[model samples]
Target: MKTKAVRMYGTDDLRLEEFELPQIKEDEILVKIMSDSICMSTYKLVKQGKKHKRAPQNMDTNPVIVGHECSGLIVEVGNKWKDHFRPGQKFSLQPALNYMGKLDSPGYSYEFCGGACTYCIMPNEVMELGCLLDYTGESFFEASLGEPMSCIIGGFHANYHTNKRNYDHAMGTKTDGNILIMGGCGPMGLGAVSYGLQFENKPKRIVVTDISDERIARAKEVISEETALERGIQLLYVNTAKMKDPISELMAITGGHGYDDVFVYVPVKEVAEMGDKLLAFDGCMNFFAGPSDSQFQAEINLYNCHYTSTHIMGTTGGNTDDLVEANQLSAKGAIEAAVMVTHIGGIDSIAEATKNLPSIPGGKKLTYTQFDMPLTAIGDFEELGKTDPLFQKLSESCKAHKGLWNGEAEKILFHHFGINPKEL
Candidate 1:
């Protein structure tokens, strides 16, 4: 079978090309990728190329496709997995396949198995390690976003607080406790806000801080204060850039008690240090951002670490369990994965969209593998509609849903492109 995918040659080198795919073995599977959401991790991978730990070293010779947060339908299921998986089944996968203690993963290391493609092959290890997942969500974008949602979920689970009496550690954030998310306007940070609000052990209050008023305002509009209050949780959005004393103002929200759970979403030194200072006694801080620099360092107060029992930890990607939980929540409409997506493009736009992801303002850049369009933001759909009928339909659908992308918009896009989801 012939498949079109974006392949990496070296640092900052990616090309979209069509090639013939090798036949799937009895233990393998073939998938038709429908939707793939561009990740900042993919941008980092492009910057480092083979230098990245998860990327293959021989990329100059054997290029690998570059996308991981993806979802689609099973085109063919090999005999070995015929009983468990069948053709025409919608699916996604846990890309962080820590198999055999190796850093290798799909999108970074695989030649025939990645997300930014029309069709791809799934190697044996994917199913063997239980990373291949079946998705029954209404939108393929939701399934594609499940991977990132899992990472957020993992960060929450990785946080731990110790008990003074038994010296025991309690997993996850404290129930009915104050929570703070630094640099919380980004897609992942906003996702943390949504998840934190709907979490089983819901926090009493969540304070989201960011430097940009535009982003903070958008976050509030998407997940409104009324919405948070309906769930019995208090949500506050703060723009620290305007404050004369940001720390004092932030701490005042918690009555100077400080936050029980603090998550640093930006890799900036100041953000990390600020999160360290905001930690309450026995507070657990999670560094959720992946820094591009290998020697990235941040200062933490040892006094608080030793005396107050405050500590910090970092996590990369989520495990299979976290992925499963994310999928379940998204499938049930408990969380809005669409909030992460701000732009939509086709497979042709992935190379530029990924290479310049940081410069591209807004949230997730969602790509449809089979379409052919430039990277266009959901906000610009109405403007683009003046020149393009396709954008006009998209603008109508998005406007109907409060300027956010939804499944109806997705179906409209697919139909406009003459691609039938049922056929795929």
Candidate 2:
């Protein structure tokens, strides 16, 4: 099948192109893309092409249909694929194709299936190890966040190791401990916020520290305001660049005792070192993001490390199991995965959407322009018996407004959103 997709040909350059792909094999299925939550990694691919070792390398150029974080409807199924996938189930795309690399996977590494495209062939590995799932009425956009959700779920599932302790401690399941995430306003960091404060068992406090006040304010919009107050999700805004000692600033926020668990999302050298200094006894340090060339070193005083019983650990992409847990959480409404995505655009608007990705005012960035309904309108999914007209209008209006986004906020009524005010 030939589908319209965002084709990446080089660094900082992308375009809407038509690509030819084989039809589903007996073991495959065809998916109609519903929603794509903009992945930071996908943005990274655009900024730094080819260098991403796992990115598809085109000898002709550096073009690849670059998107992994997505959810879609199963349109067609192969003879062998029917047992697992129905004709129209909402499912997240498990795009990271290489797991142990036993054989070729359609959407993990080089030939990864893209969520950015309108349609794709769901490979065999995707069906067998399908982390992607959707309830009856849920929008693809809501389910699309599953990829990011899976990664966080994976990191949380990892048994964090520390030389200070005799045994490996699980980072994600802690309840009584103090959870502090540095640079917690970003997408990966915010996911930690949702997982810690909303989904995880009763956390003592989900404290997020970031340099930007704007980002902190935006973060508050996604997570519950009342629940955060009730559950003690204190948002800490600090200017690390101005602080003589960021550790001291963080220390003050934790009432000078330091953190019980620190999830470090920012990869800046000094920020990491600062995180190491503020670890309390038997505390776990989770380095969530990776450094550019592996030269990024986090320093800690040896005596303090040994005496303080501090453990430092890092994790990358999660295994398939985490994806499964994420789906359940989404289905149950614990994480509110779908609502976190604030904007929805389409393939032609890829460039515009990416420009806003780095500075998204709220939680998740999404691409749902190609779809038929608003994510919210798809609720009560069990009866996938009928379509909603309101959703159709919203989706179509989103596409129309997307075409008119010229950086200047012009007044245009989105017929679908029913927001017909003269003001945009």
Candidate 3:
């Protein structure tokens, strides 16, 4: 079968083209993609191309599709998966297969599988490892977001405290302890905030710092302080760029004790060092951002690391278990996956939208594969509503849900602008 997809050939070369797909083998499954969310890592891959470690080499001969955050319906199930999976079942993927410790992953390593395409094949390893899961979420977007949410979950899991002997250790965040989230106003930061607040061992106080006041304001809109208050958790947003002494303010908020858990969401050296400095005694700092540069380095105090027991760590993606937890939490409304989405568009916009993702403001960008329209920011839906009737409908949907997109909005959009099923 022939399908359209966004393929990365080299640096500055992402092409939306038609290509033929081979028949699925007995050990594989074919899926019709419903929704795919653009990730910052995907943008980085576009810029780095063959230079990216996980990205396939020789793209000029065999270009790979470029997306991993996606959800879909099974159109054809392999004989090996027939007992567990069936045609018409909805599913999402956990792309970090870690097969034989290989760096292979969908969107980065595969030619026949990726989220951005109209259709994709799930290989035997994915099925055997339980990477493909049945999705019972309200919307396909929520399923697509499961991957990013899992990364945040994995970060929280990686955080730990060590005793003086270093023999005794505790994993996960400190319960009822003060926490700091640097660069916490972005989409992934919002996810960390939402998940952190609703965590089983929740923090007593959470301080989110960002350089942009506008982002801080948007963060408030996405994960409201009122909700945090209702949960009996203190939530504070700070614009450190405008502060004369932001570190002093942060220290004062924590009563000079610093933060128990500090999550750094930006890849910049300065931000990483800032997060490291905010760590309290026996505190854990999670460098949540993945740097584009291979040789990226940041200055950290070795004295504090040895004497104070403060440590730094980082993780790239989540495991299958983390994805399952993320899906469950989002399904139960414990985490607001909708808050992470700020833009929506059709498949035709994938190439340009991905090319300019880093420059674009706001959260995740979602695409409906079967539609044909320019990318539209959720914030501009009201303005677009003045001229376009469909956007007017979308505006109403978002307004009804407290300015956030939801399953209802997805239904309205698909009803009005989605392609007919018969056409596919």
lDDT per model, in order? 0.92, 0.61, 0.88
Between the candidate structures 2 and 3, which one is better when assessed by lDDT? 3
Ranking by TM-score: 1, 3, 2
1 or 2: which has the higher TM-score? 1
- What is residue 83's positional error in candidate 1, in angstroms? 1.2
Provide the lowest-lDDT 10-residue window in model 2. Answer: 404-413
Error of 1 at 63 (Å): 0.4
Encode model 1's per-residue lDDT on 1-424: one tens digit a residue.
9999999999999999999999999999999999999999999999997789888878899999999999999999899999999889999889998889998889999989899999999998999999999898889999999999999999988888897899788899999999999999899998999899888878999999999989988898888888999999999999999999998999999999999999999999999999999999999889999899999998999998999999999988999999999999999989887878899999999999999999999999999999788998999999989999989999999888877899999999998899988675
- Candidate 3 TM-score, true structure as reference: 0.97
Give candidate 1's whole-model lDDT: 0.92
Better of 1 and 2 by lDDT: 1
Per residue, candidate 3 scores C-alpha lDDT tens digits across 238-352 of 9889889887888899999999999999988988888888889988999999888889999999999989999998888898889999999989988988888999998999999
- Per-candidate TM-scores read 0.99, 0.78, 0.97
Where in model 2 is the C-alpha error above 4 Å? Answer: 59-63, 100-112, 131-137, 159-173, 199-201, 224-226, 232-246, 338-342, 355-363, 369-424
Flag clash pairs in model 3: none
Error of 3 at 52 (Å): 1.1
How good is model 1 by TM-score?
0.99
Task: Return whichever of 1 and 3 wins on TM-score.
Answer: 1
